[model samples]
Target: MTRSPFTRRTVLASSAVLASSTALAACGGGGDEGGDTAEKIENPDENINPEGLPIVEEEITISFMSRRSNASAEDWNEVAAAQTTQELTNIEVDWGLVNEEAAIERRNLLLTSGDYPEVFYRTGVPSGDIAKYGEQGTFIPLNDLIEKYMPNLTARMEEYPALRTGLTFPDGNIYSLPGIYDPTSLGLRYQTKFWIRQDWLDQFGMATPETLEEYQAYLEEVAASIEGSIPLGGQDMGSILTSLYGTFGLANHGNDAGLIDLDADGKVRYFPASEEYRDLLSFLAGLYSKGLLQQDIFATDAAAFSANGTEGLLGSCGVQTPSGYFGKEGDNYVALKPLVRNAGDEPAWHAVRSELSSIGNFVMTDKSEHPIEIARWMDFWFGEEGAKLFFLGVEGESYEEVDGRDELIPELLEDKTVDEALKPYVLYLGGWYPGWATDDWFRGVETSEQSTEGSKVVEPYALKEVWPAFTFTAEESQQITTIGNDISKYAEESLAAFVTGDRSLDEWDDHVATFEQIGLADFVAAHQTAYERRS
Candidate 1:
């Protein structure tokens, strides 16, 4: 079988080194920052109580380490919602904020430096890191704490069993708090999609492409009519193709190493090892060979993709949302409905699983001065009052309740945008879910007519069975990392090469064999084990 055009040997070697080195670095240390020698600090406060109100009227302070936008004028303390939280909880926070760009590095450094904050909020801690540190007692398990003090969180877990299942580690311990969004499918049901220039369609009296043939024909016409145009392009062609892979009955859950996902019947199937993947490669290859798609699809960076789209030089693109890549100026581009080559095929497009909650939002360390008090403060976020405060703002000021519905006034959005105005009054930090983000909140805050229309177009084709979020055993985690990194690299390189005709599909058998040689079976099995555990 023909292997991917890239060197798998080099990639595997590099991955092995990185995994080994990082593991060593994480494990080897001395004193406070060192791995085994770092003594876990026990909270000495004897009067701690987590279940009651006014956690501490005596003005206790806790230090937090989290990311702050380098561009925004707002700091954690300056956000109105956080200020109100301080007043309500009677807790002052010493914010140890770092620029967003350096957040991960800074977080790692702080973790290893012996001197760390009491709490980590929206810290982006990886599952591996959480498992590693939690086992070492660097971070304490919150399972008991939640049952004792977090009524809101506990209730939410009871309502959504998956929320608790997703967050629980293999050891049956909960180490982090989660952010729960409102339970609505409208906002959370889809992922990235293809966007096309509607103006070009209108100019040529053409309708949006509905089938693979139609899309290919449209691309040909666009290329023929427009000067120096790329009919199809993407910021990351590999990722774009992966997202669209489901249109051919092969789905990828973006972050996973194994392109294997459970079918409706719960059978494990790997995309790269299937005939559907070949059909996709051939279709894309035909496009590249015909000059209907960008020749340098894989080489093009995000800047170039945006530049082409913004300048109206490209006919279509696959993006997370039109607004993110094209802005309002590229508003002429409309989202494309899922297309199929044949009549009987399912139009399974990329849809991110609807989220009721986000895991790993916050974590408490053993070094915390008052774990119980902090737990109480964090638990407030899950309550009705706290949810309203975080999602909406002060009643009558930011929004008003009419007929028992929270309605936001348009005038409130007139002076400063919803996010801007709400910046001072709430946490509003990315990735931190304080619960209660409703459809109304979306409509009030950032929803535009174009976005609403686009959502409608793409919603029907959303894929149903996505890979659920699950934690891995430490051993399984390392194996997935090393094997997955190499396999994904090979798969991406091979797919791109096949599409571009740099490598022929005639060698496809050899390519499949290469995966086996590189431990594809082991990778798939690891994912299967995790999937079954979650189920």
Candidate 2:
């Protein structure tokens, strides 16, 4: 909700608009990698063939697009995130990155117009898009191709059968390669948390808040008693509170019923009209009227809000992740307690949307003849070694080791220390995950002059749980697009108006009615049906 330099954008560098063709001819029967047959990849550097499966000798460029960072585009710098396939499998990536905003339209143009790439290179094609394209003959179903060509990917698929199911269509064939969102995927992504200034709390003799009433009371203290700051500032998670109406808003998942859910089979469900949402709305309206809520919290960008916060100007604000949202500078901050609205509320977890439904990323085209070779090449990106380089940076160059753990180097933290090293160096330009990022990825540069000081500032702390829903179908997805879009737009408009005194909670009943009229009912029904099918 709060904008920042690191913030994900609404637009993308879409190039699926171009139409062209390339051919893939089968090479000799795939041999053991790099001309080695009997030897196994036992050592990190020594192990090459995916357990004796050969490296793709074919030199091809699979052009693709993304809504997020394509570090490859940044400097053509060889960081682990993008270039690992070249390093290990000898596959060259001819990447075509698009801005996030125009990605969908561009993707549609490229495929429908008869032009296609070898594959979606770690592209974030959603299940619906995969299904629609597969149905349209634009995407090749991957079962046989994967079995024949991609042992490593198949092996990973076998390990996570749920992923196999999630990625599978009702017709029972998987149309696209899947990116399994694992546990470590949590702890860093899409967590909506309210950060309160500990230093200010100490100054005002107020303890961290754990309930809605206490939160309100805390804000009053911040506004009236504190000299120059608004009592609280929060956004993003605003939907969670907005849904409850007044009782208890956990502000996780989409929070609004009919927006999203997990059915018996652990697939995504829409839950927009659930009674719980009304309570969230009422409570937020009350906060808006009381001035305990910072009216501009949602309206403000990350820089403005952070500028207010870095100097300790505000008491509380909401954020996606605790890491850089408040500036991850060692243990300068800590979580107080997860909050619940009202006095006798029960504790609840934010829904798994944080992990599930990765908004669109890199995907390949359907025109290539060598699906196996392309898939195999893509497999190397997540290969064990590739995972390490993409996440850990260049190992010895970006990091050092101590006690069998990766740490930062002296030069890495010479400037603002950990912050400078962690941003472009360790993350975007040179990320770590090639095959499968192990727990070791978190242990950055363990043996350094600033290792002692930087680790304290750089260690990961916020909390996020992976969502269960991954592959919602095309039909179900259409329903989601129709209803969720309408409701979300209305909710945002209504919420801002209420907070700014353009409207009042006295008309809360009408707001509820309008939400239902906009097909929130249809949204929830479609999601439930899809959830049952996925299950």
lDDT of 2 by residue, 1-535 (tens): 2111210111111111111111111121122222231121112222223333345444545454433344334433343444543655665565555554565566656555455554454445655666556555456566765676566667766775655655567677666655444433333322343456666568778777767777777777878877776666643445334323223333333332334655444544333333455456556667767776666766666677666656555666544333354444312444434466555665454522322223233333345544444656656545565555555666677777778877667777775545456445443332312234334564322222222232222223221332345456555565565556556777777666665667765676666667666665666667667556754
TM-score of 2: 0.73
- Assess each prediction's global lDDT (C-alpha) against the native: 0.69, 0.49
Worst 10 residues of 2 by lDDT: 10-19
For model 1, residues 1-535, the per-residue Cα lDDT tens digits are 4434435565468667867766664553223432221222133244554456667757888988877764343467776667788887878888788777887898888777656777887767877777777776677788877887788889888986656777788988888887654444344445456778888898878888878888888899899899998898888775457556667767645223236665556666567867788888888888898898888887789898888777778788776555655666577888888777765676767545534345555877766766777888888877778777776766777778778777765677676655666555556435444354555544331244454566577667765444446687766776777777778878877877788898988888888888887877877888788877777
Which window of 10 residues has the lowest lDDT sum in candidate 1? 33-42
- How much does each candidate deviate from the true structure in C-alpha RMSD? 4.5, 9.3
- What candidate 2 gets wrong by more than 4 Å, as runs, is 1-54, 57-84, 99-105, 145-162, 184-186, 235-258, 262-272, 320-323, 327-332, 342-345, 351-364, 416-439, 442-467, 470-473
